[model samples]
Each structure stands twice: as structure tokens, then as C-alpha cells.
Target: MDHQGVPSDALDPASPDPAQWPVGRLLSSAARRVERDWNAHLATWDLNHASHAVLAHLLRSPMSQRELATASSVTEQTMSRVLTRMERSGYVTRAPHDDDRRRHVITITDAGRSAFFVASDRELAASMVTRGLTPEQAEQLRRLLVVVAGERGPEDDPDLSAGSAG
Candidate 1:
């Protein structure tokens, strides 16, 4: 049976041979729901999920444009376009790095921080649309997600380990 309590032939346990795994299918369906809700919520700000994610990363630390691109897993050109749009919208500012004149450092502006906080709250609320889970359950889910993403703890990233925000 599918998550909605429907007996989906495509998801029938007996029919599934080598093509699909139940866990993978469940994760995919959940991801689709998250994507749909996230995009809808972001529509109010005229931002996409990627842009919001980039801003969230910047909220944690001011980073060089290249570092931001790497952290966000976006190409340099794409990150540049996103940054340009954000700058025009007054959500972020780019200044020359103090140590390296050639590199541009990206920082979230006050407006950006406010927007990110609002978006994060909206996303958290939307996350409850599927099913309400307790805080413990949410933490467990995060751990599972980290494992799925192949990410190590903060210790793995020296940048994250450092107390400095920039």
C-alpha cells in the first residue's frame, strides 16, 4: 500500500522486483512534496529553493563567492547570477575580500537575514503539512537524512568547526 493508504499497483510489494526499493520510493515521494511546498512558499519572495538555500548558507557565514558556490553546489556562473539578483533586491551585498582584492566576499544583509528567517519558519510550517512529528522524531529524521546525503558531522568541516562566522 502507498503512503496515502491506497493499494498502488506500481508500489505493490509483491510486484517490485529489482527496479524499486520501498525506502527509496518513499524518500522520493517525500522529496517531491517538500519541493512543491518549498517552491510555493518561496513564490511570495520571488525566490527559488536554490536561492533560499544559498541565503541560508550565507546567514551562517560570510563567504567568498567561490566558497558560496562550492557550499551550495552551484556553478560559479549560476551563483553569480543568483548573487546579482539578490544584490539588486537588497538581500545581500558583495564586497572585496580584505585579504584578497581579487575575491568578492558575500554577506547577507539585514533584509536578507529577515527574509531567511521568515522563509525558514515557512518551510518548517510546511514540513508539518505531511505529518506532524515530535522533536525527537525530527532529530532522528535529520540524522537519517545526513546519512543519506553522505555528510559527516561538523568535525569534518574545519570551516564549520571554527567559531568565526566569516
Candidate 2:
């Protein structure tokens, strides 16, 4: 048994060697581990995966909360809660749209931009999760994941908003 009281074999019972693991199991395990580690690191910055998504999406440009929720793959209510926290932290501001009084736009504050960039570097880097993989291998993994995730191209993904390009 290990320090956590889990049997040594149980620690990786699904596959003693990763090479022997099924693709589904391997992918699921890798994703869970990466998300756990990423979330832990993000907590140090007073953020989480969800908030990081919001900031990442906003990095492109200001957009309405509803649009942000869609782009971030979060519910509107959840996005509202996140925005409330971000606004309270001075990381974002919500203002009524000039032409659409019923609509509000979210803008990342200067502080938000700084926090996003800092956290973004750590959040987006695969190095934390792909510790043993070479750069070429990492690239190959990215390509494979894209296919498995059903992404045809960046244009098809709102999360990869083109507004950031310019």
C-alpha cells in the first residue's frame, strides 16, 4: 500500500505500462491528471478552469455575457457568477452596450489582462502534462487530440475566436 492507503498495483491497475493501456483509458486518465494539476496551479492565482476559460475567450475582444457563456461552454448563470467574482476582484467590468441598452458587454481590465497572461502561460502549456514527450511528440499528440475532439478547424470553433488574431 502507498501513503494514500491505495495498493501499489491499484495505483495503476488499469495498465502497468502505459503502452498497454487502451486509447480511451489512456486519454481519460491523461485528461483527469492534467485538469487536476492545472486546477491546482490555477487556484494559486485565485482562478479555476472556468474562470480561465472566460479570460482566455475575452483575450480576443469584449463580448456579451451570453456570447462569453457560449464561447466558454458554460451556462449563462455560471458565466454570470464568474463575471460577478471577476468584477469584484477588479479583473473585469460589465457595462451596458452603447447601442443595446438591454445588453451588457464584458471587458477585461488591465489587471485582468495581466492576470490572464500570467495564468494563461501556465494553463495553456502542455509541458506540465507532457513532461516526458519531446516537442515533436507533443505536436503529434495535439494533432491527434484535435481529431479525437472533432475539431475540423479553428474557424469552426467559437472558442478560438478570430478577433484575437488582429
Candidate 3:
């Protein structure tokens, strides 16, 4: 038993006979581990997955706070908090919309783009999640995860419907 009083490998996907574990345990544990590692990697740029997504979106074009929130699938309040941190880091700037005083447009800065590009290093990010799998197995896992994620998510979301490209 681990410190939590549960068998250490009970939720480990790499464990022998992990197939016997409940799907919820396996998925949650795996997600937690991967997120932890990914967060650590992103820390070098003082960014996280959420910030990365924001940078990605802004890279395409500047958008209002509400629009960013909607695109990010987060609430306006949540997006405000993220923007606040980003603003502090000089990664993004907020300015009043010309047409609407209540709306603030978000634009990524040069630093943000630089951080996003380096932090978006595909090889490092891919390895963090697919460390144990062969290239073919990793591809299969990505497809499977897309299916799982798409199951109950907004079907029209481009991020989901676009499908993985090699």
C-alpha cells in the first residue's frame, strides 16, 4: 500500500494488469501525472496549459475578454484572473475596445509569442506525455484520447473536430 493506503500501482496505467483497474481510476491518475509533468515543463516560461491556450488564441488575433473566455471554455471571471496573471508577466495587454468601454481586447506581446513558441516545442511536449509509448503506440493513444475527449464535449469545437494531423 502507498501512503494513501491504496496499492501503489492500482491506478498506474503501466502496471501489470492495469486493464483490471476501473477506468475512472486509470484515467484520473494518468491525467494527474501528465498534467503535473506538463505544468513543470511550462513553468520554465512561467506559463501553464491555460496560459498557453490563451497565447495560442491571441496569436491568431486579438479578441475581447468575453470572446477569449468563450473560446477558452472558461468563465469571464476565470479569464479575468488568467489575464491578470498574464498582464503581470508582460505576456499580454488589455485595452478598452473602441466600440465598447466595457470590453477589453487581449493581445499577446512579443515576449508571450516567444515564450509560447519555445514552450510549444512539440518534441518536448510530446515526449512528456508519450514517454513510455513507441511512436505508433503514441499515435494510437492520441486518437483514442481524442475520441474520449470528444465524446461529451461540444461537437462543433474545432479543437476536437479537426482531428489529429501527423
| Per-residue C-alpha lDDT of model 3 across residues 81-126, encoded as one tens digit per residue | 9999999999999999999898888999999999999999898888
Descending-lDDT candidate ranking: 3, 2, 1
* TM-score, per-candidate, Cα-based: 0.65, 0.72, 0.78
lDDT for model 1:
0.77
Model 1 bad stretches (over 4 Å): 1-22, 126-129, 132-143, 151-166
Error of 1 at 138 (Å): 6.0
Q: lDDT (CA) for every model shown? A: 0.77, 0.80, 0.85
Best by TM-score: 3
lDDT, candidate 2, 1-166, per-residue tens: 7654555555453657886555568888899898888888787777878888888888899999999999988899999999998898888899999999999999998988888788877436677777898888777677667756895755664544353355
User: What value of lDDT does candidate 3 attain over all alpha carbons?
Assistant: 0.85
Off by over 4 Å in 3: 1-19, 152-166
lDDT of 1 by residue, 123-144 (tens): 4653654357876677667656
- The TM-score-based order of candidates, best leading, equals 3, 2, 1
Q: What TM-score does candidate 2 get on C-alpha atoms?
A: 0.72
Residue pairs of candidate 2 with colliding backbone atoms: none
* Displacement of the residue 85 alpha carbon in candidate 2, Å: 1.8
